[model samples]
Target chain A: MQIPKPYLLFLGDVRDALAVKMARGILTWRPEACVGQLRLDDQTPSLGIDDLPLEAGRERGAQTLVVGTANAGGKLPEHWVDTLEQAIELGYNVASGMHQRLAAIPRLADAAKRQGVKLFDIRHDAPALEVGNGKRRSGRRVLSVGLDCAVGKMFSALALEAELKSRGEKADFRATGQSGILIQGEGIAVDAVVADFISGAAEYISPANDADHWDLVEGQGSLFHPSYAGVSLGLLHGAQPDFLVMCHELGRPHVRHLPHIQLPSYAACVERNLANARTTNPDVVLAGFSINTSNVDEAQARAHLAEIEAEFGVPATDPVRFGVGPLIDHLIERTR
Target chain B: MQIPKPYLLFLGDVRDALAVKMARGILTWRPEACVGQLRLDDQTPSLGIDDLPLEAGRERGAQTLVVGTANAGGKLPEHWVDTLEQAIELGYNVASGMHQRLAAIPRLADAAKRQGVKLFDIRHDAPALEVGNGKRRSGRRVLSVGLDCAVGKMFSALALEAELKSRGEKADFRATGQSGILIQGEGIAVDAVVADFISGAAEYISPANDADHWDLVEGQGSLFHPSYAGVSLGLLHGAQPDFLVMCHELGRPHVRHLPHIQLPSYAACVERNLANARTTNPDVVLAGFSINTSNVDEAQARAHLAEIEAEFGVPATDPVRFGVGPLIDHLIERTR
Candidate 1:
């Protein structure tokens, strides 16, 4: 799904910063694409971007009003319908990452229809996709696989894409989740797709490109994560990556939300991912490690990275704390 | 997803026997649940069952009219709508394994509603399920793992369940696909569920039961299949089988649809399935090998089974030809 931009991010009375993390991510990565922020009330968290009303944002060339903040139960609040309807009437396409679809609300749907605008439900709908054919596509892909959920896979991919662009190399960050879609302005939320089409959607996300071009495919749940490993495996096969960057959090005690399920060792995680990946791309190689070191001191993080690099004989770094330069360097060198 | 019992199989002018393989499966496995067969034309293949009109079938205690034949594109043939509506008017619940939903047809929907009957589109609908918690539950599960799609995973599971029942052991065949669902009269088609709920559906299919009871969970897809490994992996984690039976079709050269992609070795398939399965059930073990030997002579089939048993040190048999007795023997011994 291609979300229209420059976006006016809608933060509907959400007090928690985490609820508007998608807004923050879009502002941080693609600030130029965001025209302004729209809030329901003064209590809402500010994304540090300029605040603009619906008409003003539209006048400023905002093409879409993005519902960027998540609420309790991921539903669109009934009270916020008027603003969404007003935005639709103003000739702006409405987009949402909520569990509820904007089109499902009659007011917003009718308004968008009358105004000849669109409602992009990135989390709930995807373009029709065929099952993955396993044909070798002509592009170099680097995927970030993790030891568990929420372990910097998206961050690592975005960093790698930015680094590749900075070096004047051809690369694009392919998003496979809601927040990533907002940041990239286009993607399929593979997790929200029908189970039969996960891999097919992944294939659509990153299609055949020039042989030298790189598609940094963001991964999802880990192979060992019982709740979502299916999505992860399907994405892995569909990507058919030429290189893999293992993502992990240094101090994660267990798989997310399942305390009884312990995280696998880094070695085990890497080995298992590679083994499954080989079925689609036999030449796939581990390029580097992207460790989330936010919980550790700089010195300790550096020491851990050094130990990992020494043991695995690949570059390792925290993409957020340091940068993805070393990982990109390894990727470029190996691809060359 | 409990389909009402004593069905009248509907053969909608389908000339090919393969198109009605689901009907054949139900007849073979659960003959008691099938009252009669309904054919639109005399040219349609006979299922060796009593042929009856809709009214007569209903009088014979048929609770449901099962559209058991598949068409070219899996759509509900437009010409067959009148008969389906008539079936509904006769107060018979309708069930179909077609890509098109029975409820989506307005005539059938209205008729069913008016007559107080139900429309069951088994292939397109699933009950809501929570994400898999990866917790240990009561009762043992034995899942069939395969090297590729259509390697008889469902048949092996059904045979095992039947064999266990014959010995006066507590067992139930838990279906995961369309044909299996028809035979068992209840199941969630895991592949058709939303991607996030694949494992959840599997967990729902086989719930907690007596400690001595066995839920023979039918499997789908293959770990090495590019199009379907995600479903396989998710089902594996959700089923969390205490014992897995490796299903392989002897002499098969490649994956079912993708000829370029070769099937993995028996050792690789077993190892990968066991490794992934261990994340959910740490104590999971390989019970035996359920090899399909239809392509070979009896002597060759037995010889191949003997060779496999020697190599893997597990019982191996053609569940169709030699029966699942050896595999059940191994499972019983291991569990005891």
Candidate 2:
């Protein structure tokens, strides 16, 4: 049997903790497929633009579990026409942040297809773990961390939490940090800034405590939105987790504009997040990044969901944590 | 005749407007000497234990300006350690904004001799031009855009205004932009930020139809102080100007640990006040920076004045704008 290739990826600054967990997970899945992440700071004078071909060069068949990919088709400056062209020549798949509102999709897609890159939409591929499996959550408790409007994380966290709880097991949901600085332009650096996430978690569950299974949520608004990014790192670094459950924006958002919660595009977020965790040795990691919703009450939102599912295989119903349930039960069975 | 090498040179984050003016002035005056400016962004990521050595490699062999070099040296991790060693090995003189502080003198002398990089003290430099240079108040009036406590700009503007007024010439000084928001994290788009600096002279003399130059007198407390490096680039950028001036700090109370302002160094004053003809981009430019007052009284002030004259080879005297005399008459002659 041919060994399946794993991909590595991450988002934003590599220093982010969740990204670190995801990278470690990729390495765990296929140590040989390990690939790191890359990010360029705005302060650096333009590294004079890359001349590399995007898709073709990316598909060089390194068996990459790339932590993430580059955002080749981003807000390219007019003078960087050469750089944009180089991105097309590399044969890397293009994944936009938002589907409908994305102005660069057509151009990027044309470039990707022309180069024969396998562009997968994460939304459509995310069927909940129980969608086909008869067995429900075997027995496990999940610990989740989320920030922002807490809508996407809330839904995702609840689904996993409920699945486990229905099995007569315990699962906990924790929301911390509001990404208030993104819209409000105010900053406060303290544990209390996230409404005492550590303290509250300490009260609910001790770090030294163990369960049949344990999962920690990473990634969301706090990872990238500047003021909150550092706080998120601090939280995760202190937790010293058993496993990392990384949630990503796979396909696109259900809304036209992502507001403050724009997901990373294509290899950009993945590569960076992956690089962040290359050093941290986590045991098991399951990751997902996509948006899907069912029975949409909002028309535009519903349309966005459909578009994302078609484009990135990531919709609300699709579980980003592909084999997460099975993996959780496996751990639970062993621990119990 | 062989051109003489500059006994001193300035290193600084010339990307910062005021710092650039001061650092660049040293080069402009002695263009024959190899003068290289380095930009040490405060936000560069650290590698290993040290930062990536973003500016480490840029250290040149010539007189090192090392403006705000303190930002680089510290207990950085190992990666940064190697980078710093590389810089020192490459023979780049390192210095910091603290050169005007008493503690920096020894470092300055040592770095100068060892690295062949005369770390020039910005505050010690003087505005190259006298207050009055008897040319019609060229182009638009001079509105020295600066931070609120731009005590340097304030003093420069007052001195320039007095010169222009005494010489029967006309000009104005204005403060622009009520606040500095561009410096805020992710609040304003980078491209549109430059629009903030379109007016300053008019803000002073023509702030309102009824406003006079005296009306433009704003206390330093009113200016924005995000990091309080003592110089506010947002203010300079916002008040896009006819001519810009700043007060560079020199060691003494004339300033010892001066108040923090725009850039948050001991040089809370503009290291140099530069006057450019923005209209046609005239080749002739006027530049100025301040000296700290060591004066305990008339005798001491005069004694210090003689010392400055001997050091810089320029006719040194207490500011006539802050006084009244033949010096004031010369200023009027220069500006009018």
DockQ of each: 0.89, 0.01
For B91-129, candidate 1 gives per-residue lDDT tens digits of: 899999998888989889999889999898999878879
User: Scoring model 2 with DockQ, what do you get?
Assistant: 0.01
* Model 2 agreement with the true structure over A1-336: per-residue lDDT tens digits: 011242323233334444344333334322444333323333322112221223322554432212232233333334332333344455333221211221244664565567765433221111111100111122232323332223344345545554566676655433322121111111121222221122222222223333454433322333332223323333333333333343433333521223433433434433333322221223323233334333244565446545644654332233442323543454355456
Once fitted onto the true fold, the runs of candidate 2 whose alpha carbons sit more than 4 angstroms away are A1-151, A177-206, A211-222, A246-262, A266-271, A278-280, A287-290, A294-336, B1-336
User: Cα lDDT of all candidates, in order?
Assistant: 0.92, 0.31
- The window of 10 residues in a row where model 2 chain A has the poorest summed lDDT is A126-135
What's the lDDT for candidate 2? 0.31
Model 1, chain B only, scores a TM-score of 0.99
Q: By DockQ, who's the top model here?
A: 1
